[model samples]
Target: MDEDDVSVLVASLLRGDRRALARLITLVENRPRLRDRIMSLIYPYTGNAYVIGITGSPGSGKSTLVDKLTGELRTRGKTVGIIAIDPTSPFTGGAILGDRIRMLSKSTDEGVFIRSMSTRGSLGGLSRAAYDAIALLDAFGKDFVIVETVGTGQAEVDIVDAAYTSIVVVTPDMGDEIQAIKAGILEIADIFVVNKADLENVEATVMALQMMLDLSDKGDWRPPIIKTVATKGVGIKELLDAIERHRAYICETDRIEKMHYKRSKVRILEIVRSKLMDKLIRELENSGELDRIVKCVVEKKMDPYSAADEILRKLDKK
Candidate 1:
């Protein structure tokens, strides 16, 4: 029924209907429809807006940095879309980190649209709803979309992969920060930033980052580390310029092709996994086979892998 509703919903979105946009995202996030079919219908209108992903450890001033950037972008006359992803509280199943403060604190700015999102049970610590939100913003014709993640752990790495230019925010006295840099964020960093530059040990933090960058032996496209006290708006423009330079390079070389190809593969896998899992569960319940499979796997009578294979085989018919 939701799949039947999707085409009309998406068409209404294209006509600037906010309700349709909200409903479409809800359907996708809930997997309440033939989501892949709906997504395919909407695909051509996506990918026009720039996605800037800001991620870093907690207490790294990520929210502050994003707030400052929002001001600068508005000053430049861009219609901005902000999606601040806060971790959902497991007990309440709601966003507990209070993201709207940074977004809504910018009163009197009508050109900007600010919305806070919860991770909504995504183990990756991002949201399955995030992609749909981005698409809605893009279709709404925003010049730029800023996605700020609650940078807790490995999920910080996933944020950059979704962004056109990944920015890793850092601060002084972070113990595990250096190790996280190597795990993949360094490789994804189109630009690195050491926030809270006025703090003590600022230079030491910069040096430590430089040492790590040196160890990477990255090619000609070395990601520069910019220092910023975002609350004071220091060094924001330079960081923006660095992002521009990287954008130029990505445009000039084969990076666009490769990036899109990789994005396509990732999107395909995500769509398939979401759609197929939903379909399998529904079909199994309808046939009363889910309990049988669960019993087989739980009783030590069947391995989990074999049980999964059996389900996939059955779902293949649908």
Candidate 2:
């Protein structure tokens, strides 16, 4: 699409056209030359949606929780958008798309928009286009935007950096799993959900989480641990209440503004990082410097650090 097409697309997206919004998201995900232009056009329309991030170890029932939470949000007459980041297949570079299948219940609802994105092998757990998709959903007038991460093993805390309120979901069955997860991931939680509450060891898991929270250095706001059987929808109301409580607390204390500033800074840094890496790779490939550096390193003619320095010097010349 040309600049004129982008203009019309932006206009339609702002006017709440789902088709237009989907097209814009595709453009942003592909990092088209006019991507910044699309974002600039819609940025002002954002900052309206309340973004919630849900992350946890795999098999924690996070997707089910998100589906329940979306239903709960809809009961309050709120429009919701869900971005479920699934692990990408290395060979195919495509996601299983299971989240979409699980959330087929919402497919017929006009007020609900569900999009499943591949992690694209990002260790951070979120798709690189996640924030861009969130912005598009917000600008399209979603009342609440939920981002669910791939949540393999280490539990990427990057979701915390992007979300206004981050929820960490943990299940009771994973033996010694809580202790195995990174401390940084634990500290990022604003609310914790011990899902599968009906399962054995639920109390043990809850107590462990409570002890952890008690030991945390959260100044005024202590993260709440809510027990949930997401599949059966038990404890969902209380979970939703806890989420709202945190949202209210942040707003009351004016912490939301601080979070907004922090998230904006992160977004800017990510964009700069991506652009710089892309430019450097393109230049190196064009100059044949990348192949030469790899060959030298493989042949032990030059150390990786020295070759990296050489590449930096070449970049500086450009």
Candidate 3:
């Protein structure tokens, strides 16, 4: 779509045109021109939405928690947007889950908008399209945007940094896994949720998490662990309370500066890495070096590590 089309869509979105909002998200997610144009058009109305990121291990009931929390938000007269970040097909770069099956119940609700995105090989968690998708939801006037990510803790934590408040979901039986994952996942959590509370070892699970957090020394923002049986909707209130408490803390001391710094540094590296990789690949293609390296490895004349070092040497030259 063109700039005029984007203008119409943005105007429609502000006027509460739901169809226009969907079209705008599609436009933004696919076309860069439309993405930039639509974002600029809706810039005035942006930042009103609280972007909440929910992430965890594969079986941690993140989807269920999001479903329940969003339902509660809707009942409280708030609108919600969901971005379910699943893996992309290696061949197609499209999401494995074409739609969020768990979030589909909200489709009929005019107050809820759910969009799906692929991690799209953007290993830092979330695709290039995700930023646009979030912007679209923010512009569409959703009071809250909840991003649910795929994969285990690390991948989830990376994406949730963009959120105003991040909830790290875990289950009662994740003791060993939690210890292994603690280093990466603990740092990003604004609120830590131990879902599946009805399962065995609930108290032990909470104690383990708290003990780990205490050992990590993440300063004064001690992450509160809330236990929940998400299926039964138990402990959802405490989860929301923890979110509010963190939000208030962020505003009072204003980590907006720190958040901005963290975000910018990550983004700069993403851009630099993309450019560097692109340059390396092009150099390989031009040098006929990639084919030769494969040939050398097939003949057992050189290993993969040496081939990579040679490639780096070639690229480092002017």
Best by TM-score: 2
lDDT of 1 by residue, 1-318 (tens): 656677788789788776676676667677744556667777788778888998887768887887788788888887777887776667743434553453355545765666677786676746667877787778867788888876766567777667888898888767566675565667767788999898888888888888888888678888899999988999998888887788888888898879889987987788688667777788788888989989998999999999989987875675
- Sorted by TM-score (best first), the order is 2, 1, 3
Candidate 2 — number of clashing residue pairs? Answer: 0
Off by over 4 Å in 3: 89-99, 268-318
Ranking under lDDT, best-scoring first? 2, 3, 1
Taken over the whole model, the C-alpha lDDT of each candidate is 0.77, 0.83, 0.80
Q: After superposition, how far is residue 273 of candidate 2 from its true place, in Å?
A: 2.0
Would you list the clashing residue pairs of candidate 1?
none
TM-score, per-candidate, Cα-based: 0.86, 0.93, 0.82
Point out the worst 10-residue segment of candidate 1 by lDDT: 93-102
Residue 89 error, candidate 2, Å: 2.6
